[model samples]
Target: MTPITEVEGRRLALSNLDKVLYPATGTTKGEVLHYYAATAAGALLAHLRNRPVSFLRYPDGPDGQRFFTKNPPPGTPSWVRTTAVPHHEDKQARQVVVQDLASLMWAANLVVEFHTPQWQADAPGIADRMVFDLDPGAPATVVECCAVALWLRERLAADGLLAYGKTSGSKGLHLLVPLEPTPADRVSAYAKGLAVEAEQELAELVVRRMTRALRPGKVFVDFSQNAAAKTTATPYTLRARPEPTVSAPVTWAEIDECRAPGKLVFLAGDMGARLKRYGDLLGPLIDPDRAGRLPSAR
Candidate 1:
């Protein structure tokens, strides 16, 4: 029989605690649960509170087969909160919503990556944030992404939007702008315009198109994440890489000073100390007073 543990007064029967989820680093399922348990209370829960989540499950680790699902897995605890999400015309998927520690840990046990759309459950068609996924192609690593991020930051500020930066936990950077409840379509259009502008101004380093051939040494500014259907990796969630890397929130000063790609890479182990020092660098993104309104579309 699997041992049951109680978290926040909720009982959970956890399994395969010793199963290695990250083969290269030997990170086990128990370790992943511990990481979520440690960090969820701080700020991770707030970021995921009301958003419907999509899970990327790596039951056999990153080296093995993986799959993405928006629908809640069978046998999900009744206590877990879920919301109906519409996709592809008439179909609606019942998705998990991590509102507290117990729900977060429950999902963490099964999910390697947690993804959420820009809009919350209550306001389905409206987006409260706009994201730019800066993906570097080959010769252009995250270091190049930092340069593009800096430029985009300035451009966003000019439009009265304050942007926050975070590592994609992969080979890229994500810049998110907190909005004042704008329609998803308007947000996407504004984001795309900025990407086009960035490409024109920094042609040597930025590419707005998704063409693989044009991406060799340039950073692709992915503006489509603002769409109602697309999801982005929730901040502070663990990414399924060779190691337990996190989509960690970062500071602008750090982004401006980063000269090497390794300087920006943060693993799960670094999060506790980082939280102690910075106390949620992305807090402004969730602060109601700091939310910005999008400029009227040109």
Candidate 2:
């Protein structure tokens, strides 16, 4: 019989608890659920609450085929909150909005990597944050991203935005700037302008374009993720890598001191201690007082 447990009054039947989800590290499904159960009540939930999430499900571990789903998977519970999002040409897509622990665990049980757009479910047309995905092409790594991040930090600060940094849980860094609920197109335009400026100022280290050949030996400032339709890997979510690496938030001090790729690489096991030590490095993103307005488009 599958084990059943209650989370905040919701009874959930969890299956395949012992199934290995990260083959390289032998991390199990139960461990993943435990991590979410432990962290979701805190900063994790704050980031996900009321946001329409897209799931990258890996039922058979990292080595097996995986798929992305915007719609809540079949058999979704009646209590799970959902919102209809407008798609192209008058079409609508109903998507899951994780608002609490039970909802989080239910999704975690499916072995998913949580992703969310820049805006929340209640205000899909408006963006409350701007994001830049610093992807390092091969031969370049997070260490290289550090320099670019520092540059972008100063650039954003000049425009009155305070930037927060986090690992991509893959091979890159993500920088986010909280906004005072601006239109998505306006936010995208501002982000694009900064990306262009980064490329021009740090030409050797940065590339704003998505062209594959232009990326090698440089960091790609992926401002496109700020667009309304795109989603980013949520902070504190486990990535479907060979190991249970988390997309963990980091302090600017940590970013400045990072001299190697491994320095920024954080696994699921490190979360508890790190949380105890640093609290939420990205907490400013959620603080309404910290939100800033984007400068007028040039």
lDDT for residue 7 in candidate 2, whole number 0-100: 94
User: Mind giving the per-residue lDDT tens digits that candidate 1 earns over 1-298?
Assistant: 6769999999988889999988888889888888899864668988998999999988888788889988899889999999988777647667899999999878887855999999999999799999999999989999899999999999999988899999999999999988899999999999999999999999999999999999999999999999999999999998878888999999989899988999999988899999998998888878889999998766
Residues 75-110, model 2: lDDT tens digits = 999999999987985476789999999999999999
Worst 10 residues of 2 by lDDT: 85-94
Candidate 2: which stretches are off by over 4 Å? none
lDDT of 1 at 235: 94
| Model 1: worst 10 consecutive residues (lDDT sum) | 85-94
Pairs that collide, model 1: none
RMSD of each: 1.1, 1.0
- For candidate 2, the per-residue lDDT at 282 reads 89
